[model samples]
Target: MIALDIAIKNKYYANSTAVVLKDIQFSVKPGEFVAIIGPSGSGKTTLLNMLSGLEDATAQKLLGNSKSLHDCKEYQLGYVFQQPRLMPWLTVNENIQLVLPTAQERKIKTLLAQVGLADKGDYYPKQLSGGMQRRVAIARAFAVNPELILLDEPFNSLDAPTAAKLRLLLVNLCKSCGSTVVFVTHDLSEAIYLADRIIFMSNSPSSIIHQVNVNLPKPRKESGSTELAWQSQLMAQYPQILSGSVSTD
Candidate 1:
């Protein structure tokens, strides 16, 4: 059975005549790492928002685990957005506690330690650096042992070294949690390094245009040759895949 099955018929703003997404359909197997890449306006974030219940367009619908998201109440989902969105007033530990039905001290501590923020739990959001705050965000998401994790450009703005480190940590966390992942990013190399399968979307009124299975060996590094090779090969072979208007086939 699939962990997620997205089939959005159409999506557009309430007052707008333009369509943002259409005929977008795909299914992700349990524990699979899938990344979605597309141009700037391809509705990638919109899709995530809908799935997370952040937005509900009258004309747009999404199915998760073969059932509507509204009805999938028994399952757990975690989301890490483009920003950490931490509560400045709350300490890191408290922020993580917000998601749990009951405060879990041991689980919270383990998550922080896993993200290299064990010592910062008592610190407020403002006390930590940008990267540290993001780490806390990740820890918070994993605290509940989510069945699915949705990440929207979570590592986009960090320095290269930090982003690379977090990427590895995220992979490890996914494995330990056995959670299905759906990551959205514009970085081609990032997708290559992290995803088992990469799904490409078209521009506005986006749809799944192409998909690449990344069968590279694991323990992947950001600067690893296998990832670079795939990047170079894909760029040369399908120059317009990122444009979302052309077919690599």
Candidate 2:
């Protein structure tokens, strides 16, 4: 069975004649990591929001192994936003526990350790570095061992070294838990590194313009030869892919 089936017919702000998303449809397989890449302002975050149930998904015709985000009573979803969005007043450990009051301290401890923040649990968000805050956010998302995880540029704005470490950590955790992931990003190289398949979205009134499978070995190294070669090949084949200038036709 598919992990998710989404057919978003259209999205428009109230009383606005301009359209944001149109005829955007795709399906994610169980345990597959899919990345949706597009230029900024292409509604990638909006789509993630709809999937998370933070925004209404009435227009999102989601099905198969799941229902609309609001009525998806059986699907356990996790999300890591562009910002860590941690509760400033809450300690890192407490932020995780807040999401799952029933979660044991031991379980939370293990998660923090997995994200490489074992000792920082007692520290509040204000006391942690940006990267540290993100670690807590990720730990909180994984606390429930979600069936599907949605990540919105989770590594955005981090230093290259830090982002690379987190990417490896995120992928390793996803592999261990076997969670299907849908990550949205504007970075083609990042998409190539993390995704099993990458879907390119067109400019506004967006729809998927292209989809390419990455046959590279899993847990790829940053700027690895094979990874770089594959990326180069894709770029050569479709120079306009990243800029959202590729034709949806």
Q: Using lDDT, give the best candidate's number.
A: 1
Model 2 C-alpha lDDT per residue in residues 1-249, reported as the tens digit of each score = 138888988887547878888898888999999999998999999888887877667746877476555674666778999999999889988899988849689999999999999898889999989998998899989997888899999999999999989999888898888898999999888888899999999889888899989999876878899999999888878888888866333
C-alpha RMSD values across all candidates: 1.7, 2.0
* CA-lDDT, candidates in order: 0.87, 0.86
Cα lDDT for residue 78, candidate 2: 83
Clash pairs of candidate 1? none
Q: Tens digits of per-residue lDDT for model 1 on 150-229? A: 99999988999999899999989987898888999999889888899999998888888888899998868786887898
TM-score of model number 1? 0.95
Give the worst 10-residue stretch by lDDT in candidate 2: 64-73
